[model samples]
Target: MPRLNAGDATRREAAGHGPDFLEALARGLAVLQAFGPERRQMTLAEAARAVDLPRATVRRALHTLVTLGHLESDGRLFRLTPRVLRLAAGYLGANGLSSILQPRCEQLSAQFGAPCSAAVLDGPEIVFIAYGQPARLLNLTTMVGLRLPAFCTALGRVLLAGLPEAEMEALLQRHPPHAVTAQTELDPLRIRRRIARARSEGFALVDQEAEQGFRSLAVPLRRHDGRVVAALNIGMHSERGTAAALREAVLPTLRAQAADLACQFL
Candidate 1:
């Protein structure tokens, strides 16, 4: 059997022993994800390097994706076809989660004239599922399908806290924390302890860890049975106040909305 990639191995271990895991599918998805906003079209070499997969494996996946209409390619470069939007469209267009939470995020964002969003953990990153944009403070960096590293963001931390201990450990091992900014805490032990605290505290506060000049607070968005299905977060300009002040002023509202967000499951 071929050796699985780090991400593939970690995911299988996290789920507790799926011996029959389809490594092919995982590599295909990686190849697809390698084509992002910055990289609209990538050659086979670029795609392989981006995904850290073997060129042969990437070639098969890219060719399969092209044949299926999910990607378009000339002999040299490949880009995602419009049909790829269907994946995000399926999630955002769904009636339950985005429809229910977006208004709350919009109202909360309106209060601070900042951006607010809801996201779910996707392996080592958190993927934005919904966003609330205040007219004056549109953040182009965030939109539906946007993904950011999990160890640095409040939304990612909150979602990470929801995972089982084994799963969390597995994920951390696969995606080691790296400093994005000087303020980022990349120490593995520190991150583990912080995530443990977030689980008990029921929220996560990250200040300039994921991005400079911004602070975020997040709480888990749960289902009726208490499973954390996603996370709700408010991103505010840190120049307005210290993290402590932001906590005092906004944490209450953040927690309230996070708790209320679970009603979508009902």
Candidate 2:
């Protein structure tokens, strides 16, 4: 084989191993993530570079997304539209857990006088799908489509802990770690240990990981086939319960709500 230039090598890699469900999914998600916090609006060149996609490929994808109303452009720059929420809306509409469990979360909140929520893993982050609260004073701040780091959230752990050991190990290897807070775990080995505990115990708890002064308990929402598709959580002040107390008081309610939500998948 003759020596190949960098561009040629990149092209060869980008061409991939041919089409499959995973490749198509990866490309679509790449196109979506090309628009981000800092680069909300981008020109064709910018979006292509941002996603490391060929310019023509990005252009076609952007055009398709625009036609579908998931993206909008002002002749020069493209940005996402509120219509993009419909993509996430489709998932929530199909998953009855988020729709049903939300009201129960409200009941749990009324009974315990705390806020509760449900979340689903979207790539490396967890997206809040539904929430219920007793009072609106505390700033839980998460919205329907808002995303947060999976590694730093109880909701993430509950869903992750439900994964097979090999798959979870692979995911940890792929993610490695980056510190989000003083309490964030940066070591994959340590994270695996915590996930193992969660898997055995059927729930996960976090204190001041995603945000300070907040505590949450989460249980996996399993489908009829016994696969966890999402996580259910209740959030409150860390002072609401000690770790033990959180497991005792909050975990049961979260588990009950998770059970109720699981029926929808069945």
Task: List pairs with backbone clashes in candidate 1.
Answer: none
Error of 1 at 104 (Å): 1.7
Error of 2 at 73 (Å): 2.1
In candidate 1, what are the lDDT values of residues 1-266, reduced to their tens digit?
57888897898999886878777898899899777779999999999999998899999999999999999987898998989888878877774777777787789888867788988898999988788878876755658778899988999998999999999999999988988888999889999888998999998999999999889988898887899988988888888888998788778988887667666675
| Candidate 2: worst-modelled 10 consecutive residues by lDDT | 17-26
- For all candidates, the clash counts are 0, 0
TM-score of every model versus the real structure:
0.84, 0.80
* Best candidate, TM-score: 1
Q: Each prediction's Cα RMSD?
A: 4.4, 4.5
Q: How well does candidate 1 match the true structure, expressed as C-alpha RMSD?
A: 4.4
